[model samples]
Target: MAVVCSKADWFVTSCSTTLVALNRKQSGEPFVFDCSKAEKKPKESDGDNKSAGEGSEEKDSDRILAFAISASGKHVVLTDDHKRLVLFCTEPSWKCISTRWVVRRCTSLAFTQAEDEVFVADKSGDVYSFSILEPQKVGELKLGHLSMLLDVTLSPDDKYIITADRDEKIRVSFRRSPYNIQAFCLGHTEFVSSLLVPAGHPDWLLSGSGDGTVKVWHYETGRRLHSVDLRKFGLDSENTEKRFAVSRIISSPDGQHVAVQCEGFPSVQLFAVDCGTEGLLNPADTLTLPLSPWDVTFDSQNQLWVLLESEDMNVLLYQHFEQHWRLCDSECPELKRITDALQTQWHLFKDSVELESRFKHLYKVNFDNMASYLQKKQERLDMENKKRAAANGTKPNKKSKTESGAVPHSTS
Candidate 1:
């Protein structure tokens, strides 16, 4: 829901019907631009004759799907489910520079290395390029995959455009000449959900997928350098056929560490990037969380921010100090406010019946560990009580009471 700028000083987040920009250093009201208000007025037609309440409900359904901030942190772009793309300028003033309609709803967006052009990927398996310099022209068709795209990124030097799709394929194509196919990184067995070209190693690309593994690949040579099975950490007993997908993978801005999170697990695995090593990656640490995280990203300070998937939608911050990561007591007020607003909007828009149907399994009791935990706790309490009773010189009660003097004589 929020994308931090490469500089780490600014981030742009979609809050309800508005796109807001906040500075990491400053802490006042964020510059807000309401997308609902900025939307172009509908033309007069029979649709206008519909009930006002119905029209309002339709407008509220146009929620933002994807948003991105430029490397310079000055430009921002976001698209909603209504097939509208809006570009904004973060500096000087938070203002919508261009608002255009696209052919399909965008699944992801990224700013080119030059920051003059933006690439938008849609569910229809097409990518569109819109020029910020030439705002008058429409978005031009770019290369696309046959399957729906899940994520898109441009090489740091802007030579290749790498994209991940639902068909477990990561395609690297020439940015200038998209028709020319580069190489395909095809090891993933399921949908590739996330991709990243770390700042330190532009040649190597990191990806997370529905296969429950995070793989490092040489995008140019199509060689997989390393693969980590996340399932081993917390899903050893799960069915091998059932997917425990890696939902998000993010590298710190310094490129020294990468965070990997799975769909159902509440732990984030951290790996240190070793460009010189044969494996190219080493397990650095793991952060256990209270709830499964929906997304994770590092701030400008190299601290981690995790967005929770629960109904509260809490955003947690973890700071790295003394070579260890710990939860920060201080909070990002701006991020907190944005997430609160998002949760409210989510409740309003979410369909309870559909959600229940989709996540019925989650509601079911699967307390495989809870029973063991309670058993261990009871054992510990019993031991403590025995120690206390022994220290107080208390005798244990017997099932058979002494039968007066006859029982005492038999003992003698």
Candidate 2:
């Protein structure tokens, strides 16, 4: 299922072939972008037939893969399975700025600190930089990894372009000189699924991995600071390694707190950054989810927003009151309006989330080769015994124990 991707005041949710964005500051209608309705257009530069406006057939796989809201919150970008990178401008009104194409289906997209350039990370392990100023321009190959990249983000100063991959490594490189390697954040035993440079903490980086822990890092130096194991906070019955991978890591606007969500798990683990040590992760609270969460984010007001698997009450808002998160689902009418608008295509959201559990295969499976080999050897010996008994003229009752219901001995 598609997850809700948000930054600042605007929170957006995408499903199969469409996306909905709403500004919390206004009661205006949510902007709906449907790939099925997007018409393919010719690029002015190379006449490449990409799409921007609506009304044309798209692929069945043309679902939104990743999206990002500019740090300034004025621009929004999302990549779809159709290899189309769609951009939107929020001010003056929500408008489609351009439709560009990526070399491969993107796994993550991020706007630089300046929002002048957007980086696209694809399954091919390559990142392409697209120009926001020159919306019609094609992307330039930036840098790449040896394995599929799952998440990409820029340092707060836009000095470093950090990327995490399925091979369990986070590479930090110079944004201007992509080949200038800064450092690598290593330690995750499984695929890294999400990355974030928390607000107000430029030197610090937070990453979530399939191994079930979120690690804090100093991006420039590649120093590991702290880590949080989400399994310790999930539902008691759901503490197995299978429910581990940290799917999303979000910081409150003030950067005082960070929230971590595990895929297919029913809890959001909150952490207080720099609470005890200067640069450390401290467990604060675990927001018990009634259902598995799709994503979590903190709006400009520091209110926590959670998108769940349920269609009836798809979005929930929480306020940090008295050192704990208090529910405001029925109290916030603005959020209520957004939830009502999403209810129509809510099934799409549900279906999108169901498809996201594809990571379970990333774990290793077990097999015993020795047991099978020993059993075959014993069967061969029994066959020879049966033949010798037939030639010795022994009664058929002495059938070499071949026809008997005797259990075979298993060796350690």
By TM-score, the best candidate is 2
Q: What lDDT tens digits, residue by residue, belong to model 2 across residues 92-183?
A: 78899999877677899999978899999998799999999999898999998998899999998888899999889999999999999999
What digit string (tens of lDDT, one per residue) describes model 1 on residues 1-412?
A: 3333334476555544556565666655667666666776345532542432134343424667788888877788888866678887777767778888776667889898789899999876788899988765679999978878888999999899899988889999999999997899999877788888986788899998876788999899889999988766655455665556665677888888888877666788888888688447788778888876656778777878776655664567787787778887634564565455445545433322122211123222336786687667666666666677798898633222232112443543
TM-score of 2: 0.85
Model 2, position 251: C-alpha lDDT score: 90
lDDT of 2 at 98: 93
CA shift of 118, model 2, Å: 0.6
**Against the true structure, whose lDDT is highest?**
2
Q: Please report, in order, the local distance difference test score of every candidate based on alpha carbons.
A: 0.72, 0.80
lDDT against true structure, model 1: 0.72
